[model samples]
Structures are given as C-alpha cells and as structure tokens.
Target: MNILGLIVEYNPFHNGHLYHLTKSRQTTNATHTVAIMSGNFLQRGEPALFDKYTRAEIAIKNGVDLVIELPTMFACQSAEFFAHGAITTLNSLNCIDSICFGSEEGNVDILYTISKILVNEPDEFKASLRKYLDEGMLYPTARSLALFDYINKFNLLDISKEKLLSILNSSNNILGLEYMKCLLKLKSNIKPFTISRVSASYNSENIDSNICSATAIRKSLKDYNNLSLIKNVVPSPTYDILENKLINNFEPMFDDKYFDLIKSIVIRENNLLDKYFDVNEGIENKIYQNVFTSSTLNDLQLSVKSKRYTLTKIKRTLNNILLGITKEDMNIVKDITSIPYVRILAFNDKGREIIKAIKNNSDINIINKFSKTSFSMNDKVFKTLIDYDIKTSNMYNLVYYKNNQHLLKGPMDYYISPFYVKNMCFKK
Candidate 1:
C-alpha cells in the first residue's frame, strides 16, 4: 500500500488546508494519508485555536486517514528542530511512501537545491555567514545575506537575488527547505512532494480570497464573533465546528492570557535560567529581568526583543519556560536519537488498518491511550518525554475549559480517547 505522510498544524482546518489535503492524495494516488500534526501548541509559539483531538477529528472527517500528535516539545521549536523531529517521526513509521508539504514556491527542485547548500554548508558560505554574524546582523538576515553572496559569487543556480529573497521571505518555502534538508541529512527513503500555496500569503491577516491564510482566519475569528466571512475560506464542516466553538466561547487563545503563569515560571527559574532549553546567550537574564514588570506575553516579548532576538524567538523561549522543557530534557532525547513513542490523536476505519499494519511492520510504540500502551522503554526517559506533552495539553486545556467538560475537573490527558470520525461525523 502506498501511504502518503503529511506534516500539519491544522490550528483550525480551513479551505487552504483542505485543498492541500485533496491535492496531496491525488498527487500521490496513495491508499492512505497519515498526518503528523502539532498537538496543543504550534510552531508559531502559540496554543492552537482548537485542541489537538478536535483538530485531528476534523482532519480525519475531511480526508486524512490518521492523525498522530507531534510531541509539543518539538512542535513549539524553530523550523530546523521542528522539521527534524517531524521528519524523524514520519521516517520512523517505516511504511510511508512519500511526504507532501505545501510551499509558496512549490518548486521541489529549487527547495532541494537550497537544502543541499544548507546540508553541505560550503566553506565560502560559512565564512560569509560568520562575517555577517560578526557584523551583528540578526541570524535570519545574516544567513540570507550570506546565501545571497555565496550563490551570486559561485553562480550556483540561474536565480536572482530578489527571487531568492522572495523565496526566503515565504515562510512555507523556508519550512519546505528545512523539510528537504532533514530528508537529505537523514538519507531517508520517502520521496518529498510540494504543493503551491494560493492567494493569501503566510502572514497575511485579512481574508480577501477563497483560500485565506490561517492567520487571517484566526484574526477574524477573534475580532469578530461572526463566521459569515470565515465561511468563505474554510470547509463547511470546519466552519460548522468553528461556529459551534464560538457559540460556546471556546477559541482565540491569545498567548498573553497565560502571562501571569508564564511570569511565575520565568521568575521562579531566574537563577536556573540556563537550565531551560533555547534560553541561550544569557537571554535567561533578559527574560528573568523582564518577567518581573512585563504584565503580558506581548509586553515581555517587547521588553526582551533586540537586534539578535525576534519576538517569535522570545515567545518560543517563554513557551519553553512555561512547559518546563529544560536543555537537559532536550539533550536526553537527542542522545537517544529517536522518539520514545507515537501518540494517535484521531483515526478513521482506514486508520485502523494502518495501525494494524504499523503493529505488524514497525517497532516503534503506538499509543492510542496511556493505559493501552504496552511498550518497554526506560521508565525515566519515557516519563521525561511524555511529561512535556502532558503539561502542554493541560496548559492548552485550561484555555478551553468552557467547551471541554473533561478538563474542568483536571488535566484531560488520560481521560481523552483517540477520536474516531465515522461517516464524516466526529466522535469523542
């Protein structure tokens, strides 16, 4: 059976996502489509609009056969680490034939070329990068300048600086390059495919087209309780779910809402800031000092932002602090070089077949629920990794308490079951 693998956030499934899903299945002509999706938190260093189980259920109801959770630790990281962890998980499945992702350029050839440069890191490019870094340029700007210099000097490809800049500026293209780099670095067998994004740009915050950016949809949802305009950009099924969620006051989790809790965590870890993952270059002190007076996540980020650190970077670091994901924890998992387990969020009948295939064909543990798992892993290591996921879920569930009955009592990790969507209907 040809199985297509996809990486998704689906913060709230929309028309753009639906198009990508439909095209992915058609392009691969695959029997099954499996998605590795972000859990509660997303790559953008924010909690998802809806919970993971709800999002996964929507995915399966639309087209995805199975949805597996990307560990929160990796999901809320930078592009490189996020791609590395996601690609690693997809590769671990051992049955996927291809991995399809959406890109602004949709040119796998160019993406692959960029990936080669990133993977190989030619001497001249590295020197240029170092020179720009020494000049105190932000990492992203410095890397872009370095690549521009090296590419032009060597005449690597028949491309222009402006075109390259456009490519780099496109967030989807950047992620597509990272995905390609991961596959090349790992020498994995799964083929990579790209689908071009249409209409709205990645960061666009207004819905002006049928295929609108998720950012736009989210912003609209928050500013206006009405879904009339949003209905244009998302599938009817997704729209219905979103409408219901809005009616119940279950949405738009602005990061600043957890400011008090995040501040407490940051202040508590002041002396031990070095322990937190991604709080490098003495950024811990900045966060520690800022946490004292910063009232909101936005305030903290603005107070801590600098030439070297973007707001997104600061937010991610703060998120790590909130989850208590230490550098030591990251190192422990990195040392093992493999995820301890894969958690299934939602699936259909086709997904049941895929699970059976996984059991018979792969060695990695598949967790439908905590109690149902029977895998032999070092107790300490297993707990360490799973703790981050549980904590992230509990934190996200806190935001959805109005709609989520299970979370009202306590954390919903154990009580939550793998959602099953049958006949395009969502089931808890």
Candidate 2:
C-alpha cells in the first residue's frame, strides 16, 4: 500500500492545487493520496471562501483519494503547530509511506539551512537579530536582515543562497520547508518529497492570466458573471461543482456573529486579558481600549495596529484569545500523544481501499462517527476558563450541519467526480 500524504487547505480548490495533487501522485508512485485539510477558519484568520466539505469535494474530484478535515483547534494555528498536526495525522494512518509538498526551491539542503537558523540561533545571529528587532522592524523584516547579516559573516550569500532565501520568503516554500522540518523533528520514517508549484501567487487577490488565489476567488464570489474566472482554474469537474455555489445564499460561516462574540469575550475578561496568545507588548491595553470604543471587529484591529505586526497576524492573535489558548496551551499541544483522527468528507473508490487498510488497525483512531469524537466542546469551556485565563462564550444556539455523505460508497464516489456532479452529468 504505497500511500502518499498531503497537507492542504483547498480553501477553494484551484488549478494550482490540482497540479500539486497530480505531481504528488507521480512523485511518490502511490496508489492512494490522503489530504489533511483545514476546517472552518484558515490560518489567515478568515472563514474559508467555501466550507471544508466543498473543498474536499474539489480535492477528491481532482486527484486526492481520501479527505480528512484538520480539526479547528489545529487549523487556525501557527505554521509549526499546523504542520505538527498534519504530520501527526499522516503518521497515525500507519500505511502512509511518502509525503509530497509544493516548494519554491524544492531543495532539501537549503530548507535545512533556514530550519537550522530558526531552531539553532547562534550568538552572532542572535545579536544581529536582536539589533534588527531593536530598530523596530517587523519580525519578518528583522529576521530577513539578521539572516543576511549572519550569512554574510561567513560570506555565504552567493546567488544560489540568495535565491533560496527569496524562496524561503515565498509562502509555498516556507510551508514546504516547515513540513519537512516537522517530519524531521518527529523522527518519523515517512519519505518526504517536493513538487514546485506553478502559476499561482499565495496571496494574489485578483484573477489574472488563468491563475487566481483563494483571496482573489473569495473577493469575486458575489460577481455572478465573473464566476467563470474560477471555473477555468480548477479541474473541470471541481469547477463544475462550484458554479451554483459561486453565488448562492448558502452561508458557510457568520463572520459578523463570530466578531460580536469575540468583542463580548474581550470585554468580559477585563482583569485577565493579558494572558491570551499575542497579547503582549501592551496589546492587552489596546484590546481593552478598543473594546470600549469600537463597534466593529475591523475598528478594534485598527486601534491596535503597529508597524512591527501585520494586521493579519494581529487578527490571528485575537482569534487565539477568543479560543482561550495561550503560550501554555500551545506548549501542551506540542506534546499531545494521540493519533490523528481521520474523518472522511468525500472520496472515490480508491479512497475506499485506504479506509479498508485502516479498518482493523489498532494504532490510531479511524473515526467515522461524530458522537465518538474526542475533545468535546463542553470540556473545552472548562479548560478555557480554568487553564487559559479567559471567559467562555455563551452557549447560544449554534449551527451544526450534519455532513452529507451520499458519495461514500454510492455512485457519487464510484463515478461522479466533483465537476461531473456539479455539471449534472450523473443525474438520473
């Protein structure tokens, strides 16, 4: 069973993602591909353009064999934890032999260099990094400058090194490298490989030249006529699945509602507001000041803006606070001892075989039902208030959609791919 693992967030699947999935299959020579995808919120702090299930549908239609949702707890985390969660999930599957990722450089040695800098900061490098930080530079800028200084100390910034550093700054390679580093640190036996991504910018916010980022896709969703822009970028089947959804009343998440809840949580934590993740450097005071002054979420963020921190990072920190996670929670998550719980959102006949392999496996939690899901929401409320020093949100009415799994073993999985289903090709 030569299975390959992919860490993905097909927030809205596109042609670039399809390309990566295809390349992953060929590179690993694997019969099955497993995707550990993000759920609800993305790392960028916004709800996904569509829902995770829809994205998984796109993936399964395109090339992925099995789709498992990465739990919300780990999905909206920093890259280190995100990668850790994904690697842990893949390793638990027991049959996964290779991990394929898209990289800007695709050279293991170069990524290892940056990984060393992050994990093993030498004295000169630390001093250089500190000097840059003291100058009030943003973390990325400071790290870039310090890295250059440190590399120059040893006359190592040759053209190739410079190119690799530039690649490290590119979002794809940074994530790809982090995946490798996580696998390395775990001491897992899975083989790792990279496939260079093509024709898509990680943060591009507009459709151009048949390539568009999820940001671009989401921004254009309301424009009906422009939905074709996405149609051209995803696999024909995946694209078809999206046409009706491109501009429908189906709301995946109520961001405004989440914001109001966040504000309430902030206001109620008057005394312990300093304990949340990213609530440092006087950010807690800003949260307090803004909670009283601003009525909207964006307004509160504006009140706390600093040159050193990006607004997105600030939003993520706020989310961490809302979730009642602190540096301590993060520390504990790093040492979690459970296997990844795989939940199928959509799949093909090939995916069935993958499940068959895990059916009797005694090593990990191959869960198909939700009642048996660990980490209950009820327990989190207690943990949040007691451990993370934060107040809990009111257990108001919540939308809990039962998953649609008609495709599990029916014709949808056997024949109708994502696009075909969207196109009505398999309709009776």
Candidate 3:
C-alpha cells in the first residue's frame, strides 16, 4: 500500500527520468508508483514531444504502476499553479503515501523551510515583495529577491544567504519548493522527498553523456534526425515509441504550427486579446503587432518578451490564447474548485487496485471515459475543466496532422480507452 506519487511531463521519457524513477522507488521503499503527467501541452507553453498516451504507456513500461492526466488547464500554467494542480490531484487520490520530485539541490530540509516561509508570509515579507514588484521586477525575480531580502533581514533560518540563493536559482529546486509549498498549504500528510538530478544541465542542448535533459533531447530530435545519438540516453521503451513516431513520418510537434495557430487567433480577434488568460498589461497589443511580422515562434516570443515578462511567460500566455482560456476561466477554477476530476490515462494491474481504492475513498469524481455523455451526471465544473483537456487534445492532434499528413492518428481521447498494460514482469 506504499504508493509513491510523482508529477511529471515525461515529454519523451529520457534516461534521466528513468534514473529518477528508480531512485524514487528505492529511496522510499515504495511498492507502487503513480505519475500524474501533463496532457499534450507543457508548462513551458509548448506541446509535448509525443502525445500523452504514448508518454503514459512508456511510463508504465518503464516502472510506474499508474499514470493520470494533469488537465491542460493546469499543465500549461506557471510553475506555482502547475505544482498546485499536481499536488492537489495526488492528495485527492487519498492513497499516495509520499510525493517525490527531482531537485538540483536535493535537500528537502532547505526546501521545506522555504516552503514554510512562503505559506506563512509575515508582514515584513509581504512588504518586501510589494516593494520589489513596485520596482518593476518580474514576479519570479522579484519574489526571489524579496525572499532573499526577508530571510537575511529577519535571520529566518540557519541557512546562509548564498545557499538560499542557490535553491531559488535552480529550476528543478524552484519547482520542488513549489511542491512543498503546496503540500504545506494544503496541510496534507504526504511526505516530500527530493532526488538529486543527474541529467545534463537543465536546458543544455549539448548531449555528451548517456543522460540528457528533455530540452536537449527535443533539440536533438529537431536539429538532427539521427536516433542513434539518443539511443543510450533514453530507455528502450522510450526509444521504441519515439523511433516509431519518427519512422512513420510523424515527427515531434514543432512550435511553428502552434505559433501559426496563435497568429491566426490574435489577428482575427485582435480586440479580444484581453479576454485570453495571462494576456494582460497590454501584452495583447505586442502580440497583435508582432504576429503580423514574425515568421517563426521564436521570433514572436522574443518580440513580445520584456523584462516584465519572461519568454516562457509569453509563450504560456500565447498558449492560453490558442486554447481560448480566459482569465475568468482560471479565476473560476482556482477560486471555486482547484481539482474537479481525477482522470486516468494509463495503468497496469497494480494501478487498477489503486484506482479502486481511490474510487472507494476519494471525494472527487473519477473519469475513466471521455465521452460527452460521461459528464451527464457530473457537476458543471467537471465539464468546464474536462472541456479544456478535450480542446487541448483536439488541438494537439491537429498540429500532429499538420506535421505528418499521412500518419494521421485521429484524436483518441474521446474514443480510446485508458491504456492497460499486461503484466510483462509477472509470469503466472
């Protein structure tokens, strides 16, 4: 009954992901592992390298017992919201014992202390954060500076300022911190564990070793068609799935397709940009003007990015526009019910047991099927949230078709059943 939960994108499950998966089980003595992964879109405002079902199947083949879909509403959001959604889903499962994540620092104690500070923001801390925001710094940078300033001014913890800075500086550690923050905010009993990342640098495109970052793997796939270079870096199952897609002329989703879609949306609805989620502070005008001139996704992102908003932020906002996710949608989801439904993507036998346990104990609704009639008895929020997931899948499939006209696999979310893997390791 010792189930370990992980929140992941698995955007083409690589060697580094495998290492973390094995280490997580070993360290926690977990009998089962559950992964709540992003649907087609990712937090970085890009579509996954492969479809969600393929990624979920790979996760099950590797070692994970269960795979659940983190809805597109949260998947394509900022780090805090993404962490909040994943943690909330795992908590709703009512079966997970602990949640483990990879961090650059690999120190849960430091992360825990910082999480407390975030959850229990004192007056001085709030003032410092407000000061930084007034100074025109972006929220992420401003928050980091504010934390650094507050911790030193009040001697918050025993950790040094330099050490604290390093924790915030690392991307994985920042995510790990957010996970801890959410867990504490929810007052959940699930323990937190951090596994040191062994991959190449977070976003480094240079692949010199067997383990490389997902960013680098995607770059390699786009820049070179040679699958041999990454064979050693990804597990056998991952390699097979990716190779099959590539061989079938169904390449990874390129950003240009998404950018073109966004461009069309922005140009046609230029006056309605403010209605899109995260397209505030006059960013819509920048997007509208730049979409006409930019030829590539990178060009559009760079043109719209400024000190106030990072490139990733701009891309995430654009993703919201493409999906027609408005600020009102986010507010309703967040303020009313953060997680409305728990949806299964892929599972094995052990996962089935977990699902049964969840069904018996969980307070949230469970979704194993994706048809319109499936929501006939559900709440309006469930329909609203699930609709976003459906739209994301439809859009992802459209982009897939644009990339591979001949290898068209029709949208499977609505018609296909949750992927079930026969027990390959257990012989009866």
Number of the predicted model whose TM-score against the real structure is largest? 3
Query: Per-prediction RMSD in angstroms?
Result: 3.1, 6.8, 2.6
User: What TM-score does each of the candidates earn?
Assistant: 0.91, 0.77, 0.93
lDDT values of the candidates? 0.83, 0.66, 0.84
Task: Write candidate 1's Cα lDDT for 1-428 as tens digits.
Answer: 78889999997899899888888878887788899999988898888888888888888877888999998878999898898889888887778899889998888888887788888999999999999999998887888888888888988778887898899988889889988888888788889999898888888998887888899988887778567878788888787776777777676676776787887777776788778889899898888887778767788899999977888898888888877888988876653445667999999887887788777778888887876654355566667778888888888777668565654766677778899876543211
Candidate 1 lDDT for residue 131: 99
Model 3 agreement with the true structure over 1-428: per-residue lDDT tens digits: 78899999998798899888888988888888889999999999888888888889999988788999998888989888898889988987887899889998887887887888889987888899999999998786787887888777877667676777788878899889889988888888889999898858788888889998988888887888677778988999989988887777776876666777888898899988899888889989888888888889899999988987789899899889988888888876763324768778899998988888887877777777776446675576677788899888999888776656655546567676788988745211
Candidate 3 whole-model C-alpha lDDT, 0 to 1: 0.84
Q: Candidate 1 vs candidate 2: which has greater TM-score? A: 1
**Top of the candidates by lDDT:** 3
RMSD of 2: 6.8
The TM-score of candidate 3 is: 0.93
Our tally of clashes for model 2 stands at 2
Instruction: For model 1, name the residue pairs that clash.
Output: none
